[model samples]
Target: MADYLLESLGLLLRWLHIVAAIAWIGESFYFVMLDRSLKPAADGDAAIAGEQWSVHGGGFYRKQKLVGAPAQMPADLHWSKWKAYTTWLSGFALLSLLYLSSPQMYLVDPGVNALGSDQAVLAAIALMVLAWLGYDLLCRLCGFREGLLGALVALWVIGLCLACTGLFAGRAAYLLVGAALGTIMAANVFFVIIPGQRRMVAALGRGEAVDPVPGLRGKQRSVHNTYFTLPVVFAMLSVHYATAYAHPHNAWVLILFMAAAALIRQFFVVWHSGKRAWGLLGVGSAILLATFAWLAPTRNATSAVTPNSAVAAPMHATELPAADTAEIQKIMKLHCTACHSAQPSLMASAPKDLRLDEAQQIERHAALIRRQVVDLRIMPPGNITSLSEAERLQIARWADTLAVDPAFK
Candidate 1:
């Protein structure tokens, strides 16, 4: 019952997070496009940097780019901070519900490093805070030089990816990186961008000239947020693809993927101004192709016995004896029941309601077991159950045999 309630809460929070992220990203993209597409006014005004005319939803709108704070402050000013705030809040809630609440099952992998639940949660929190602080400090020190700052930040992220993968499960590490980046983006709005705008508005109200530095700084952070969008989206979506995160060098996979996403974002950013960025697209494609080639899943034989022991040839499905119902039930009990049974001791809930305790239940889930265990090798997540290659083949052969048997129905 507790698990069911948490699942429902997670769903609600995830929905809210997605909706808020969409709104924030849309606003960001629209403004970036507008900024890039702006043209000098026909009748040049000293205070007008540029202007854009557009039609949306059967309504025409004209927007002016002010060279500085407007001479007369508008009575009503719209702010874009709330969308960012809501996204971060909802995302954090989802993270807590899904990961922090069940660290052993979702966040920690004994193969990576044995991290107690409390230690892992504390590390995750520290990662988020430290990432934001490092990024903020880097921008403050060198953000005036765009190219240098970009290079430095990229290095920092790459280092962080390596560190995270070393400490946490691959999927968790990727999500942590995304959460940190998202926090930086939102913090930019809350701590730097919005505050700067408010100060400008205050000066405008007092009939005092606004400092251009704050506006320039805010623009820098806003542009950084745009570059982060594609990478963060990729990180969020990568949870579904276990192959990428389940590899030995999953950190490299993540870093390369994020690099590709950033390059693609750059292509779009430049393309918005009628500029061709084919080079960026080409580089991104090459990175993705290389990643796919390197990470393709293929079964290989590596003897598990001691070096002094005689190594027997690996077994093939054809050489193995026929796997009957009894054999299938035994294998399922040995490998899957700890977490998939009705009264699971290892996990708070039976994942996906995949109970393997009964014969009928195992037969009913035969196809799914084949996919997750035989094909993907992604179940028994983190290989926590110590599922062996021979056992996986046994399950596969059993499922195939069951498919032809009339009793399987």
Candidate 2:
């Protein structure tokens, strides 16, 4: 019952997070597009930098960009703030519910780190906090210089990727890094962008000459947010793809993925500004191709067990027992079915709906099982089932035998 309730809460929070994120990202992209699409007004107002005309919902809209504070402040000004706040709030809530609440199952892998649940939760929170502080400090130190700041920020991100992959479970590391970047993005809006805009508005209201510094700071943070958007989204979605996060050198995989995302985003940003970005697109595609090649599963070339043992060492399918269905079933029930069954005893749902309740079901998901269990070693999450090296070899042997089955081909 507790698991059920927690699952429900997780689902609800996930839904809320997605909705809020969509709203925030949609608004952000729209504004970016609008800004790039703006042109000099025909009836040039001296205070206006650019203006855009659009048709939406059967109505024509004209939006103007001011060089500085207008002669009079508008009484009805809309703020694009709550969406960001809600997205961050709901995302953190979901993270707390899913990972923090069940650290043993989700966050702490005994193989990766011997951390207690409390320690793991505290460490994760600390990382998020420290990430925000470090990023904020870097921004301040870099000032408004885009080239220096971008390089420095990229280095920081790579450092965090390495740190997380070494310190936490693969899945946890992936999510933690994502959370760190997300926290930074949201805090940029909450602390720098919105506050800076408010100060500018307040200055305008007082009929004082608004200082350009606040607007400059706001624009700086906004640009950073745009660059971060795609990378954060990839991190959020990466939880389902075990191959990326569960590799031995998962840190490099993350760095490569982030680089690809950033390059792709840069391409779009430059293109939206009416610039050609063939180099960015080509580099981004090359990175993706490299990542895919790196993530491809390779069969273990060596086995740890002796030849005379009941379980043969990891080898080609010809060496494996073809009629070991009963033994394989026992292994699945012992190590897998607790979480991957229709009536799961340990968790709320069968992850990815790949159940192991029957032989046919197992056969259907045979390749996926091999990918998650043998190649990536990400299943039996957090090693909660204590799936041993021998057991994994056995599963690998079983999976290898599936190649003879036409269905598998």
Candidate 3:
């Protein structure tokens, strides 16, 4: 009963978290698109101040506001909040359960770094805190509304992301960066935004005027959050791919994926904002190419050598059993030759090492396919290629048929 209760709570929490995130991101996107699409009012910048006009969701929604502050408090004025706070709170809980405590498997990558699991988790937390602090300091020093601030923040984030990826497993690094980013977005609300609104409300209650600077700051931070949503979503998913995480140059690949997603987001942002569709189309094209580059697996330095022991080794030539050479060749060609081939006699992606171009190479790494396709369910990631379960089962069965001679096993 206790276990059942815990499981039920977990499911409910996840559902709520997902809904909240959707609301937060959805509002963020709507505001971004609306802000960009807003046009200058014909009546001049009055009726309020520092305002814009837009038509959305089958109606014209005019969001006009005082350049400074309203003269008096209206009986009913809706507050735009809770979305940010709830999103942050829920995301924090999820991260804590998924990564912060599970240092055993999620935080440390023995293959990549020499650090122990405990050391890795500590490093992750420290880095996350540092990233948030550094970004906050940068904002204060540079001025959030300043154009250079955005570019500087992006550059700094990329640097920190690279460092984290190099230090930890690919997924942890990405999540750490995400946590930091999420912190900034939430802080913008809790620290900068809500406080500003409070001040405005207090002024209104006192029948006085509020300042615009705080609103500007809030808007700037809000815009930043909008741009972050798409890329962070993609980064969150990238961790599941062993090709992306365990690859020799995993960090570099992650960087490319982030940049590409950002570009794609920008492309859509421009298109919805009514810019030249071609420019947006070009960005879309670039995103596709970038994704292709990231997924198109290439061999890494560490994967070159096969271990002498079959237990830990990526299968090798000397270890192959007396399986039907012709049948094995046919299976590899039909099932894997599409992506794992160097020349890729079929589709795209040679996918980080393990070329299925030859019979010997296939035999050497048959066990890898078995593990990835059968055991891991990580290959054909996102089911992009739709590899059938039968194919995966066939590979696994063939692998099982291999002779378990002590010398090889």
TM-score for each candidate, following the candidate numbering: 0.86, 0.92, 0.70
Which residue pairs show collisions in model 2? Answer: none
Question: What local lDDT does model 3 show for residue 388?
Answer: 61
Q: Give the TM-score of candidate 3.
A: 0.70
For model 3, state the Cα shift of residue 189 in Å: 1.2
Query: Which parts of model 3 have CA positions greater than 4 angstroms off?
Result: 1-8, 42-45, 49-66, 298-316, 319-409
The per-candidate count of clashes, in order, stands at: 0, 0, 3
Q: How far is candidate 3 from the true structure (C-alpha RMSD, Å)?
A: 10.5
**lDDT of residue 276 for candidate 1:** 96
Prediction 2 global C-alpha lDDT: 0.82
Best by TM-score: 2
So what's the TM-score on candidate 2?
0.92
- lDDT values, one for every candidate: 0.82, 0.82, 0.65
lDDT of 2 by residue, 1-409 (tens): 8888888888899999999999999999888888887889869887888998889999999999988777888799999899999999998899888889889888887767788889999999999999999999999999988899989999999988998887788888998999999999899999999999999898888888888898898888898888889888888889877777877777888889889999998898888788998999999999999899867654444542323222234555455444355666777899899988899887788877878978878877777776677666677788788887767766666676675664432
Weakest 10 consecutive residues of candidate 3 by summed lDDT = 304-313
